[model samples]
Target: MEDLSIQHVHLELSENLEAHRTQGFSNANALVVRRGAPFRVSVQLKGRPFNPTTDYLRIRVSLGRLYVLMPVTFSRRAPSSRWSAHIDPTTSNKQTLFISICAPASSPVGSYRVQLSVFTQDRQRSAANGSFILLCNPWCSEDEVYIPFEDQREEYVQSDSGLLFKGTPMNLVSRPWSFDQYEPGVLEACLNLLQVSPQHKRNRTKDYRNRCDPVYISRVVSAMINCEDDRGVLKGNWSNDYKQGVSPSKWTGSGDILKQWAQSGFSPVKYGQCWVFAAVMCTVMRVLGVPCRVVSNFNSAHDTNDNLVIEEYYSETGQKMNLSKDSIWNFHVWVECWMSRRDLGSEMDGWQVLDPTPQERSGGVFCCGPAPVKAIRSRRIDLLYDVPFVYAEVNADVHTIILGQGQVVGFSKDTEKVGSLICTKAVGFPRLQNITGDYKFIKGPTSTISSMSSTMSEDSTTSRGSSKGVLVSLSLDKSPVAGEPIRFMVKVMNKQSVTKRLKVHVNAQAKEYNHSPSDTFWENHAVLQLAPMEVTVLRNQILPAQFEHVDEDILINLAAVLEDMSSHERFLASEEFNITSPELIVQVAEESIVPNKDHAATVSFTNPFPHPVSGVLTVTGAGLIHGKTQFRMSTLRPGGRIEQNVTFNPSMAGVKMLQASLSLSDRNIVIRGFTMVHINRV
Candidate 1:
């Protein structure tokens, strides 16, 4: 009888093992999975084929220190999205086999190495090896992402969310923005950010908070957020002297950011504020299969010290004092991640905060959180991460101080303004969920304001905070059309019993939303005289060119300050508006196509403005184009129409979404359009 000993054994891993080999898939640490999901490892053997009735296939799986040994059975059916081949030992000399394993709840998250051997007789043993990484199965009820949630499932699953960008206090939160978490480069970037060192690559499965750990991944993001490195996004210089000289309109999605970052050789991408940082971070998290959401905290305090109060000192003439070390952003954005709290205790498991913006430093680095939301809510300040800092952002009070003749004059506090709205994307809807009560003590209505009189003799010269005295209101006249004047009305009231003189300043600036407003495109200054309890209205208009950049989305930020010259009390308030670009229209010849057949698609648009545009058009879709296809075009004359045609063949059977984007590089104009094509299997 022929010996059952195997001549040679080789192993590889991928859903498409053949294609993976052809594409040079050589990542030693490439395998990634969640518990309960089937992980497939492919094995190929060539030898004197042993009869399966006499020989057996034995496999050993090693996850860091944990190990499992199991026997493999031959099957003709292929695994889902995977390749498996049957071995007819009597006729076939070469055989390929797929071993699919599902990790149970007790299995820890980490890299797994597998060894396969054919052993039937006691004298023969032949082996081959391969490996993969595993994570907590968030989709399973046994995991933290689904275990603790009673809310609808969509909020935790949606890739697109609503954010309030253009309104007073950001009350309007339903403008839809996509997260595009499944972009290929986003996952690559997240992995590259985490596995930076060789040690990280070597010892990834050792600890929950180790270098390859998700917590460590979040930390790497923070340290890299200064916009000074290859993957950095925001340039966070809070000093009065810095300016974002270039404006790149509103980003379409996080995929754009990751693509730009990767294309630039990992160099710093332009213009990211808190929301931009939060939004992109949300994309990275979700792309890596982590459940994440963007959260906005209005009147977010940058409490320099551990104390939960941001103090503001104003001059007698009612000008804001920038004298304090503490600062409060108008609104601050951060990300909340879902995971089991292995670092903290069980009760702390839920949403953990992870800030990617270059804020204050922690542990000698610029990262923050994975600080448990439960811990922040319960006032557990002594945790390992920045609990006190995050707590201050959501629950701190704004302590306002007024000074007259360089001395303490008045003291006031605003509780409602800080953390007024804590919002995330509404589950399964195009709306926002206000989760403010989740952060604050909501049993009784929290106090909005508290005031006290302090002696002017004491030295109150050093305090500075954020305030727009007594909730002043500003109104916009009408919606702004592109290439049209922007108009707004500012109304100030003299609430005292006597007549008073007021110094009112209206500053209107055009800024991109991804950066702070620094340039004043238009301004109006006036000294007005008002009677007791009288209202004064100032109407201001700015020309279209003032707010319009060459080819960028302009954000109109209006800051109006009404200062009481006699009483030295001031009211400062601000509002925001959006200027949008025209859309690119796409019309398809047909809605459906048969598999392996070609369909023609046409995209067209007119240049409404006087200037000509020059750029590349990037077309992308899954199962349509093999990858993204780009076409370059130069200046067509002013008012010229751009109509182009491209042919796409369906590779698989399914509904496919095809999108085209025209990026005017020099002029910075972006026009996007999409259409759906059905690929029917015949």
Candidate 2:
């Protein structure tokens, strides 16, 4: 007899086996069987050690041409073991079970290997590893073998749920992947795939907010703008060729018709044609789910040209279309979109003309020629579409058309029935031609007044008297130092006229350190003049004192006070010019020294001028003691003096070279009566 001992037996299950069992046998067990023999296999389950009351088992054996396996079920109340009788024993304690087999008498005989598998709700086992084999008669005919081929017509079996395919599936051919190939349904499929996983679903909200594909509406709007110069010829023609066949369902009545045309490849120019084109394009964009509007202005100037130009178009008959150019007749048009608001807030409300014409008369029109075969001449105005115009002042009668949610549709020198209109009051513009006058000092409460004449038009008038009696008093809460902020208040009251507006320009100039003998003081200027009779506070930091032992002058220059104009042709004072001190000078004193310990000395400083003196009194020299170096002082008056004690320590016992100096502004002045001392150490 051959050795039949089983070695390395391993039992595994798909899920927890013990938790689902309550009877005579645990699901985690291996089965032993013999080849070429029929055997009855039975299993009896025993309850867990703690609960031994239940003992049950069930085993079934069947022989058929085909095999169908179902999950094993358990009933806890049943206590007896179930049995099936279908086993054939060929040797001592050696038997096998004929699970399923289909073979004819004519089949060729050979040893056949078969795999027998058993499955429960949570477990599965197979016996194919050197455990099972079948032997057939050597004289069996080949006709007994059943093998299927591709020649049979295959049909899918349909149930209440869905179609099912039979037979083994073949591998599909490979191709390159493309995102564009994904259909609308693919998006839903992707969403479903993402949701199937719990972890992915948990992060879905965050991913949607951060990684969601943003719609680039600007690209679509850019395509519709169509700023080509050739389409400018279609301005105002309103022909079918110039109009885009947009469905009314897409566009609202308030939309610009010309914007629609331009977006649909109609208008292509900046002047009249471009305006009309932009209007149509805007309308078309609105129809395409993009809300848009139009804007119009008169005497508009282009930044490039710095002048205003009229927008005109040539007819198909080679005749020029004349547009009104009078103050009331000049016009311009531009289109804007709501998407701009998403990117640019309130500024997006303004219209951006597709092809903007130059607003200046000196600027020429942008020329455009048709293709060689078309033989057409045209011009396009290239204007920035997204620029914002915060303020607009008109001096003539002008008409503006607003379309598509308050978008300006048309700007015309000529009034249209549906457009907004505004009229400007006629007034002469201001100009400065000549300002060549001499300054003269006068005594008394008023400074000298010079007669000034202007070449403004006779109809022009001036009001508000000069600020001749204005007085500016400067005070400091605390004395100012170099690199510190100084506060000042300017006061003006006495005025020749009260009705006129006043504007003042104030500047301060001082002598720079190390200035050449011929070089005057450098003047730093600042202007402050918005309201009259109101005190204006000014703050500034002072530069470091650059010169020592010398007088420095601070000069304040007040420019001419301009007054607001009235109905009559005359000049009046807006405020009085009562500046108390136009210039202030202060004298810095020389340094004097007193002897101290170990060749150290104390230096005193005084200010000769009545005004307070502010500066750093630093003492620097070679072989000076550490921590005895620099000192800062402020507000030294005419009779007040500040003393600073400094010590010098020589490293070696010998005469040490020492030099004391003071830095004021950028100039360095040496202190007198200081000598090198010889140190003798015993």
Candidate 3:
């Protein structure tokens, strides 16, 4: 094959339901459908209509190497149109052809090559040659899941989120992770993850069970894709690569991760966190004919027990203690699989939650979920697998244990924060759909949260305590760069009338974020005296070595211990900061360039990491190299310097923005830079 071209075919469920449209112009693009369903498509042709040699036009559908041709058939008021031997346009000149593909009820979901044109024994011409994805609809078979055309373009094929690396995951509903699933590497890796190799199979039936069994397949993929098992493809050691200069905070797509895994002789892809694990799992599930979407739960809880209560111990000085297994992550990413739980009743069907992050064990295995979110929200712990654990993640109550000298002091109850902003991509669109209300129902037989609760201790319930006399808080700087001094602030206010003498101790620890808390990495202490109702702010700086631990990944945990010396009462506050490396500095040869004049953009950076890394620098903006340019990069040794120069000419004059990023081959690491220049008219 010398070349290939892709064209988009605007598809809709019906003329009335025009809101549902699907099209793609790359191998990475596809029109998704469910197998054995009334999947109909109206093909609207782009470009000029070709004169047909014959009276009848035919559609040649190719699956693998096999090809079958069917004549373009549809009922119109005029019967002559279907009977005509040459199905070319009449004088009226209509280019649109209506195609109703009748796939059997049990047709295997996959991709197919469809060519719509007028063909004869002597020759054949191409009108529309494109591919489509057949997804498994285990529910009622009528395609309830509607995928928008924009989603097919950006959400399915484009993997990077609009937000840059180290951006907060809190406001991610505004950003989309366009996952390009059709990439060759991603497709291959997905197929390879199945137990039965695709090459060894005779046809679709060879491994139908291993391929379509949602429960079994999900479990195998959840474990096998993460190196929790020796047979897994990727090792999910989070702290290893994340906090270090490596590991892009957000994943680009599945292809890069898949490519890296293959290069390592199938050794596990290194150091994936929850989002990385979830994104890869989404690709695998989608490629395997299972419809999947990545979901982000802000303030998601990790309930250690079946109980939904999350308890936290804190020193009277406001320092949070790390004693409970119950905790809430700022945000958690997991995948929701669309499939019928045939094993369960009709009520349990649809949208099964499958977490590939390996947070907790299910059935003595490192895999979790296939547990129905409906079951979890409905408080149906009676259902199979891990419903209770997932319920607590969304509905756990927070109990803050305040203690002085290792004994419990006054307690604070916080119901805010955990399990809010539960969202997923809306159907038939590329925006967020908040289904938080789906989990907000009160607990009962009708109570989803309470019924899912197997046990509730006294600590589980609490009435928030009254405010303490003084206020003390600890906070880290917005962005702390590695190899530099990190700054933090301690704010204290003595609201009482009398003077206050406060003993303040601030400790900075390097913690392995994805796992249990590690030992303290550094410490600082100071005592202060303040006048009545005085509000004082103290700023402190920690040396680079203090928070930089030997672990490949690190999180700076700052704890502030405040003591009222006169009363001997204490309060505690803490904050966590993810240390980001310095930005990749972009230096342009000149600040101004005339039209048609070439200018150089030198993207320079030093590898702050210990190992050698290879990557590509991509430059893109409105008027640069047809709007995009990619330059391959060589590997750089530890602490090596890279000053890549890319030259581009300004065809038009104005202010132009240049966006460049140094992205590693596997895309585990990415450093971004941007520059704007005035383009002088020649």
Candidate 4:
């Protein structure tokens, strides 16, 4: 009986990983496979062929003290929720037995030990020992993270490079991001995120068991992305003060951030905003085998008090005042992970919103969602995981009020402005896809702005009210460009037949994309006389010098306030716009890019500002370059052009992007550009 033992075991690592759609994780140097899928291992018998009646083979998989044993069977049966093992009839020989093992779809995702035991008449002998790392399976139908669409699964779970939509809806900027899940030490960092979690520290057994559900894992990831409550991955900063750490806008990929975090003994990496937090979380989720995508919500509201109304105040002179805790960002970025929600039933089993930004606390922790998108569309606010907070983000109402002498003079309610657009990167493409309908039902065209009199109470004003005897609208002739004056026209019409005397005050303020505006940088006040039933257009211009010295990439808020002298009624119209920055030009001279071959790329830019500018130019690529290549430049005169020649060797064959950014030394501005290079395999 001792002679009938196992000699050696061979794990078909390459073939199994390819079959499991996990070829990208081959760098882990372990048998990395997904759950709910069967992997094969060949066992060579030392003595003779096993007899089914007198001898039996069983497989043991264990994590710590918890273990499961499954007997090898010849008969094939339907898949079940338990561990299963069967012999591959076509590959079995007299001395070599090829066995297939399938861990349940609900198996815990982590490292597990595999042992083969041969049982003879009265004794069991441990024959071979091996190990594997299991991940969530989006390809398995029974798995909670299963996504039906092949293209979607590939884009969400496999693609390493993506685009994060920022700026305003009108001037959308598709910022390139390197998810970098396949980069060195990133996957290990993702696994480390789970190991260092509070749940794992509190109760190891329970944490391991709960990892089987994507919902549980997502909640953990959401909390782990922000350092508000735990020793998480990234520390969120919205104050535009990044003196102690790298600025969030300067991050090109998750690889450096994750590697830095792990190398620093799990210390929180400083300075992440909405997009940075969302992009980093996407990398972690994709590394863990969960399907995830970054989504941008334009005009996203932060309802601090959960009242579903964001109150914004403006002075009588059209200067925006920071009088309320609730505010609306130009755009807010978050992640949506695809999974099945058994707890909420199949109706709620599609895309789930998981925001990692520490905007609001949930259950005493700064994590959000696994809240089903369908549930949000249906207004199911009672669901768990901060659904109400997310619901208010994209569907809240904006109450704009004009305060004069401590009295509300003019008021308006904008129901459509809070969530004008919601989008994500398209599947299998490099463009934006509108997903606004997924969050809220589309409403037909209606007057988004409704103005009211000072006598109307805030609660009594509805979304259908109109201004008394006047109608106002703001319009821009063209998009605002950097180094050029921003010119816009404000049209105010007297609806009534009587003539009206009015005061027209226009205010221009510089603002961060995610926060309220600063003090009024440029404002104009004028008294105008409107003839009976007259239509007048007031033209305004904000010069380039007025905002070039502003901090960071910012937006300009242009607001106009009109007060009727006869009736003392005031109306407001405003436009928020982003000034387009100059882009860097990247040119690769070679026609065909090959791996391990030196390539010359040129990064060229001209001074777009009025004064001389000097800064450091940084170029980064995930798989194309080893690390970032930076060049410091002297002050170039206005309209002066500079070209930098960069040489790098391609590490592997794929489509890679070379991203370049020029951060000005004189001002807080970053000019970015990218060019895709498709490499040929050797």
C-alpha local distance difference test of each model? 0.59, 0.25, 0.58, 0.85
**Candidate 1 lDDT, 447-547, residue by residue in tens:** 33111111111112222242222223576665555545767676765555678787777776654433345456677788888787777777888776665
lDDT digits (tens) for residues 558-674 of candidate 4 = 888889897777888887877878889989999989988899999999888788989999998877887789999889999999999999787777677788989888777888888
TM-score of each: 0.70, 0.18, 0.61, 0.92
Candidate 3 lDDT over 309-355, as tens digits, reads 78877554444568887776756778877656767876877678888
- 527-570 in candidate 2: lDDT tens per residue? 33434445454443333332122221111111122222332111
Total residue pair clashes for candidate 4:
0
Ranking by lDDT: 4, 1, 3, 2
**Predicted structure 1, TM vs. truth:** 0.70
Alpha-carbon lDDT of model 4: 0.85
How close is each model in CA RMSD to the real structure? 7.9, 36.7, 10.7, 3.7
Better of 1 and 2 by TM-score: 1
Minimum summed lDDT over a 10-residue window in model 4 is located at: 450-459
Give me the displacement of residue 218 in model 1, in angstroms.
Answer: 4.8
| Superposition error at 409 for model 1 (Å) | 7.2
> Which sections of candidate 2 miss by over 4 Å?
1-275, 298-329, 340-342, 345-682
Clashes of 2: 77
